[model samples]
Target chain A: MTNDNNDLATLALRDVAELVEEKLIKLLPKAVDLEQQVIDAMEYALLAGGKRVRPFLVMESSRICGVGESSALRVAAAVECAHTYSLIHDDLPCMDDDDMRRGQPSVHKKFDEATAVLAGDALLTLAFEILADEQTHANPRVRCELITALAKALGANGMVGGQMFDLLAENQDLDKIRITRLQRMKTGALIVFSGESGAILGMAEERRCQALRGYAHDVGLAFQIVDDLLDEEGDSDDLGKTAGKDSKAGKATFVSLAGVDAARTKAFMLTDQAIQHLDIFGDNAENLRNLAKFIINRAN
Target chain B: MTNDNNDLATLALRDVAELVEEKLIKLLPKAVDLEQQVIDAMEYALLAGGKRVRPFLVMESSRICGVGESSALRVAAAVECAHTYSLIHDDLPCMDDDDMRRGQPSVHKKFDEATAVLAGDALLTLAFEILADEQTHANPRVRCELITALAKALGANGMVGGQMFDLLAENQDLDKIRITRLQRMKTGALIVFSGESGAILGMAEERRCQALRGYAHDVGLAFQIVDDLLDEEGDSDDLGKTAGKDSKAGKATFVSLAGVDAARTKAFMLTDQAIQHLDIFGDNAENLRNLAKFIINRAN
Candidate 1:
């Protein structure tokens, strides 16, 4: 892995994560009764933690667009909820069949499969609920845009469709273009949404939003390639997940189809393209440029 | 079952169902690729069709409030999407473990569990997406309100929590009050939302909204009690579902706690209370009044 002197901290990611962490707990409903079981499962899956990439992207991107920390934090938390819900459902026995997520026992393993399913459902519902609130944004139009955007990113035609393609891809060999399209729908959609959210909240000009979206798109694909490489090359302990499952499942991923050397080169090249998209922001986009570099270089 | 000469036709339910049916198919994205399996599962689950009670409630309530038929139709379709999503998840092997719904094999039975899960998830996402659309309501505020209402009715503190309570209730003997609370959370919350949605779309006065809410509450409870009665007494063929599963599972229900006679009487009393809440609207509420009566008396 290529280590960089500059990391996400320079971008206020720590502050964003801390604020999002605090708000996530407050955002969760109290387990006052019998239903606490599912709530417990939800908190376990949500708070067990990931690197908080989506939240960081939402907050930092929103910050660059001059959106308030408070509003960005709310949107960030909602993004995490949406991300966590996807992880929970994806790790189900019928899906990825993973037993660990973010280094913790998967929701179905920690709780029951039924609890896991309901917890994911509740989390997904909560994400929309949070975005629909006044605290997320003062303008109803802005809130509606956020809601629709989030829905589009994760709906049947987006992430869900991508997952379906992935399941099918395991049986049939897929070419690079098909795999790229699958990865875009599967993971890139949400990443694009994460990057675009701040602009939507800040009501940034169309061109700026498009610029951020382009940057996000390039980095998002690069990020997935790195993930594919890690799945093939990294250990589970470092990845904090069951690594190499892609190869073991006969899955058609970039790393599986393209040689590791070519895959790594593609990731780096894509990261460069991503950084180029942020050139319009000049010095102000320094953090985003470095963030792209960091994505391709991260070990876990 | 209590037979009534007047049925849902008096409320224009058939027209609402027809329009909502068309809109539902339109609202669902076309499956153009490998992901068609999940989309097919979604369509099967959604279009297999329940009685379309939620859509009817939304359309009729909106009609009484002078909201346009087109706007009501969109909201109605959204409500049905949410309803169908819940039903899909509820019938999963991990949850109710039912095999039949709307006289068709459950999603999990028809397709694979993964497809069923994704289909349910996509339907839930589609519901929020539909509600967030400008076509659903011209005002962004109204759209936001609808989104929040649907989320509140379905999230961890709402229907999800209620389902958790229900799963726990099966292990221990519960009283009628507890059963009522569980039912309120599980099914009643969505039903209440169906009734209140028209007013939310109309931006009706607080008192009028409260009236619809109250009417919805009573009718929702009455509707559940009748469901319990049907679970116990109705044939599986008539119900178009696997009846006696609740009793088979030894799940404590309103009918289990209170004798059939008491449960039946309570349903009628609640129906009367539901009808009384419509007094303010007088002639305008006749359809709602008949709707409430029809809810308690429906054989299915």
Candidate 2:
């Protein structure tokens, strides 16, 4: 058996993922006769292999903030759908030009570019559709807030905005502040959204919600820094596609600004800062604290 | 001055459009300078000049339903934003491939394709964001319902789905039934959403909402049919773009399916049906009724 210490966190994460996954499968409407093709594409993208890190954050924050599992599951699925849409668009030829994802051909590579685009667009719209279902319609005010938060996280000021900045930053020697801001918007915003959404939906105290946002912001930056580090040192086989591709693509990353060692140190500092934000919750935030450590030290 | 009969409808529409335009122009937060860029693209598409028909429908419907003009303006802007996003995306290189819009270069033709795509995506997200602003936070349930309605109108089951069908039907013979379904989803959904959303937001009677939906549906189909006839007969200079491009692209169209005379007749019939739906509301729906008549006889 695995060591109980790490296993406990792993077990909790797995349980959350399993529960969210089951809820999603149940919530998704199966195609009856003619719309099977569209349904199939949706299922393929959604069910494809990936660690359920975002959903875990959603559920963990909700639980810690005293929200029930059912309500949090809707928020979890909504974020996952948004993330999946980003992945679909990012893999397009005009975008990242990626042909592989998660050890399989990307959506466009497996199907076609048009289909992939539509699938991504459909998933993005469906996220809000699912959240507005009759089951969650009871909390109408909170539901609208969640929709607004998710849209802001996904829109120009959030992920798409960050992407535009990243695109403009290509091949340029960028400063540390600009690079951090870019990553914070592109990668960190959604992560913050994932955790903060849970807090908002759970009706957590305003101060606690603010604390969660702070925690997520620091963790997200540190997480991306670690990802940059891994891309420098990890093997393509382990990464499922590439390593050092960022540098080759003239992309700006933390390692490009500072040496690998310095980037690593900065990453650790961010992680420590992230953990410090959890001090208010004390031992109740053990999973979040441990998750940050795991993210920083992740191998594959 | 314009004829008194025409003056009231024209002046009221112009008043509503100007009000919504001013509000939207001021809504983007100045804290993020990048937001200005987003607001610029959105305004470029929205304010460029197209009659502001969709916004007029929203505002007029809201007034008929006893909804306040302030709340109506927000939904009007939201509907226009959604419509503008569709136009931007439809003009992209991978989609309709048009080069001109409202007598100017298309969003993609003017800006880069990637920028246009992001702009369209941003505008779509902004619609929800604007609705959820603290200003309108008073009616969260109404906001949530409108957001869900707009999402559905734009998703695969609606405009995007209809576009997919059109793309696949190119150079292929599609039956009149299939063509009707395509136009209904692609064009009808949003118009229906525009008319129905006002009533939904105003808490109008369910029967009145249904009547508005029915009226909007017929009018939407009539608008498409009229557009088809114009494409076949309109001058490029007068229409602000090259006419007959639909036939050049070998795309399926109502004129191609039923011929020009039949198409015109059908448009008139649809308009009549739409006006009939408004009879239940009588003079209160005069603006909507006049709007339907105007749609069938539009010059561009």
Candidate 3:
């Protein structure tokens, strides 16, 4: 946001924010009278916008799967709430110990550690609430399916497990396999769901869902590889947070294990594979293809 | 658990735990490889094992609604997972700052804060996952209703809002009405869901659901009043966690505002009202009626 890098990705996110933000604001309860501090913190963290890439994936994926735009937007906001919750918690004093996020003070820094924790918890809870609500879908079965996928993506074997793995990696010597697994679990599972959501909503065939998931998996890894690249090479102003945090924390990343050149090549290859996975959708997937390229080329 | 008071409530909990814990353990993925620490912490907190009151509420409510015991157990485990997650978070240094729970080290005390945080998160996610799974119910509609209720109960306006109120109370003088509202939001919402879950599962009449919810509301209040009383008069050895924490932290509670004798009378009145609400169920509500009476009589 501070810098105008990754024009297409930025544009895609702007489009998503336009489609998703108003509804997200409505979904979040406004603090009226007493005990409003944590509510304030929840709103603050959510409003601190990143590129909204995950929401974009939900939108584009749904577009390909023929889900209604309004329904897709609901899922988009839900996933973003989940993503934002993870970021808030990850920025805590005990986790990554970051003081800033998305070019602003982290939730814990803005409020206290306790408020940040509760806000994150509330946001995560809101995600499921949105999906479970009748507004998300006409059929309760479809809604239940979505809730299950999102819950699994966020649970122990998914993001939380990946976080645990990442933390332990700081003290242990992690190889490429373990690091890649960590990256996939930490970030890939949710991306897979984001892309797969539209398919699920539309009740698309298993073949199509798998195709979207495949694209998401490759793109997710490419996105993380590029993140490692940016964290290694970019500035604090450009990244909106500290650079070289992976190295500083002694955490093993794709770029850390493999040098910058190899990591860049891997990212590019993954991007290509990701685009190939979108071929089944033909012309409709042009935006998705562009998204993959934009992901690797993003400077910050 | 150690006090052996409230025989009916304790016996009901023991029955529910026996029905629920095995399924809960199976649903939780065991860590056979890397990133086992957080998983360990999650199990530790869950296995620390209180009297399992919430799960019992779900089981008994479902039984009266004619739901199968096996099916009811799933919902019971799901609610207990949620309850355990809340306790783990509430014990963090930034929250209640308790080092022990149920005569054992708190999750954050046994494991590091970061692990405790992730474990709590994973458990919460797992609750939704359990609810949404096909194994929980044959009809997704029932599952979705359960999930929506649970999510609402756990979200900002429910448990989280109540927690925020309690935290703010440390700095402000809260009146009886405000404290009652706070208690409802923080603890009452989940208990209502726990009682209402069975009706939703069994497709009971709205009247029945409301009656169960009415009973739950009074019982939840009585339960809290007894908790405050225990905090004021019971020792740490009996309560398993620190006693006198409410006064020590300078937080306002029912007992603090109403005094010991008045609070005791109010709890008994609430317990009586709770039992009366279950009159429609007749002999089938025996355990439920017993649970209401036990709430005010529990020593710890």
Q: For all candidates listed, what's the TM-score of chain B alone?
A: 0.95, 0.93, 0.96
**C-alpha lDDT score of every prediction, in listed order:** 0.87, 0.78, 0.88
Instruction: Tell me the spans in candidate 1 whose CA falls farther than 4 Å from its real position.
Output: A1-12, B1-4, B8-11
| Segments in model 3 whose C-alpha atoms lie over 4 Å from true places | A1-9, B1-9
Weakest 10 consecutive residues of candidate 2 chain B by summed lDDT: B29-38
RMSD of each: 1.8, 2.8, 2.5
The lDDT-based order of candidates, best leading, equals 3, 1, 2
- Model 3, position A65, has a per-residue lDDT of 90
Question: How much is A148 displaced in model 1, in angstroms?
Answer: 0.7
Candidate 2 ranges beyond 4 A from true positions: A1-11, A26-39, B1-11, B29-39
True contacts kept of each: 0.80, 0.47, 0.74
Which digits, one per residue and each the tens of the lDDT, describe model 3 over residues A3-67?
A: 34357666777888877888788889766447588888988998887878888899999988999
DockQ for all models: 0.83, 0.46, 0.75
Error of 2 at B78 (Å): 0.8
Candidate 1 lDDT tens digits, A224-295: 999888889899997899888898989888888888888988888888888887877778887677677677
Which residue pairs in candidate 2 collide? none
Q: Per-residue error at A115 for model 3, in Å?
A: 0.5
TM-score of each: 0.97, 0.93, 0.97
